[model samples]
Target: MKILSLPSSIGLASKIAKNIGCGVADYKLTRFPDNEIYTKIDTPLDGEDVVVIGNTNTDSDIMSYLFLLDAAKEQNPKRLIALMPYFGYARQHRVYNRG
Candidate 1:
């Protein structure tokens, strides 16, 4: 299994990787002048199990996570696991009033 982490979750991911005695994958993220996101996975993940760690605190973070997930899926890994330390808006499970 391989571990991939976003900038926000690097620390946590490192700890997990150390505990599990696994190596972390290399990836790069860049932003364009127009505020677009780009992701490049440097490590090969073909037929390998992958775990992506990220936190969703804002719209940009969410977008980055989605892009990362899509990129990972494109690589056709054997299995994909998402570890979200913080998931936004997950507590609003009820609707008190309907419009």
Candidate 2:
């Protein structure tokens, strides 16, 4: 099993990795001048279990998480798990003024 820690969840992911005795996968994330996200997984994940840790605090963070998820899916890991510590939109669960 491997943990892919996003910038926002590094500390938590590191703690989890320590307790689980697993290593963190190497990855890079960057933004293009056009405000697009690019993600690259440096570690090989063929037939490996992977856990992605991220917190959705802002629009950029959400986009990064989505990009990460898509990239991880392309790698064809044996299993993929998403750990979202903080979901910023959880409070919008209800639509009170629906007609």
Q: Which candidate number would show the highest lDDT if scored against the true structure?
A: 1
Model 1 ranges with Cα > 4 A deviation: 93-99
lDDT of 2 by residue, 1-99 (tens): 989978999999999999999999999998899979999999888898999999999988989999998898899999999999998788877897886
Per-residue error for 15 in candidate 2, Å, reads 0.6
At residue 16, candidate 1 shows an lDDT of 95
Q: What is the C-alpha RMSD of each candidate to the true structure, in Å?
A: 1.6, 1.6
What TM-score quantifies how close candidate 2 is to the native fold?
0.92
Tell me how far the alpha carbon of residue 9 in candidate 1 is from the true structure, in angstroms, after superposition: 0.7
Overall lDDT per candidate, in order of appearance: 0.92, 0.91
- Give the C-alpha miss distance for residue 20 in model 1, angstroms: 0.8
Scored against the true structure, residue 81 in model 2 reaches a CA lDDT of 94
